[model samples]
Target: MRERSVEHEGRPADPDKRTLRLQLLTVRNRLTADDIEEAGAALAGWALKLPELARARTVAAYVSVGSEPATRALLDALHARGVRVLLPALLPDQDLDWGAYAGEGSLTQVRHAGRMTLREPAGDRLGPQAVTGADVVLLPGLAVDAHGMRLGRGGGSYDRVLARLERADAHPALVVLLYDSEVVERLPAQEHDRPVHAVVTPSGVRRFRTG
Candidate 1:
């Protein structure tokens, strides 16, 4: 099948993902606080209905920062269900380490050099490899195409996470969280870019067939 493309403001589609990322970020940065809250609640409602998440014994997720689709509700929901929720803690090298989410109270604000501050789990660190134990991994991305290809911020953190999973032969359900507008028709992909199994938006869920 041919790759699809999403038109921006009736303008021609840009094949360069960097340009697209900037456009998407511009739109996201415009979101109001109320808009973020409503989208977060709706996203949580839709995401919690996913079988992958519902049946998951352990979920690897992140705390949403800035204008990203809010994941606080979903994280708390998973915790309330008695599921083991693992949140990522950024290492000095821009890689991620795992930590258990105890609740909203369990998170601590961490500022990293040359990066946006993050809200990370305050519990003991669980080593980077702990993600291999998750039944589902919720990834943070700027956008996802119809083909499930994700466009992430330049940081190579999740790329490392995916590579580690491959090395360990782990097959967790990989999911991306985004806004409805961020679910586009296509995105430029590199050889190292991994297709996600599904994406959860405020409106609904979209799954792709993956090998």
Candidate 2:
């Protein structure tokens, strides 16, 4: 098993970090359709509350391939607002292949990461180059805190992406998505952990300043 990369407070994350993440996935599965709709509504409202988000021209959002938290609502909202949307095409070696998300019918699924995807072919894809055009980036995370530290699935996909963003001098308001209760006062951070600029939850959005 992968060792815990984050330590919360004085305690490192439980040795079962992987198990916990998988369990979170299970919990996500148990959410009723109504619950998912409510959660998506809340998240969309929360996104709208952020002034910059309303003004963004391009955004990177996930396609809810299956039981994962549905991002279709948010993506539709963004598109309705005349914003361009992008979805990360899962690539081998844990890298991201970004492509334009024109709308629902534009996506097709093919195996990439042992999971399904709603993606378009990314011809001549460049990670940093793709992100340079985005004004907002919605990142997936297992958990988050008030301070904006994100716990990902531990694949290092996001870490590498964020690092590329930094290298390209892209500060496009990093936003991590999480459940309402996932935002705590603190979360563990290691030397390599990259912090986000804000977090989006079912309840609302919280911005984080330098710690």
Say which candidate scores most in TM-score: 1
lDDT of each: 0.85, 0.69
Worst window of 10 by summed lDDT in candidate 1: 1-10
Steric overlap count per candidate: 0, 1
Clashes of 1: 0
lDDT of 1 by residue, 1-211 (tens): 0011233223344459768878998999999988998899999999899998889999999888888888889999999999999999888766789899989899999877655678888889999999999999999888999899998875678878998999999999999989999988988887777999999999999999877
Reference-based lDDT, residue 87, model 2: 77
Show model 1 residue runs off by greater than 4 Å.
1-15
Instruction: Please report how far candidate 2 places residue 172 from its true position, in Å.
Output: 0.8
As a whole number from 0 to 100, the lDDT of residue 74 in candidate 2 is 87
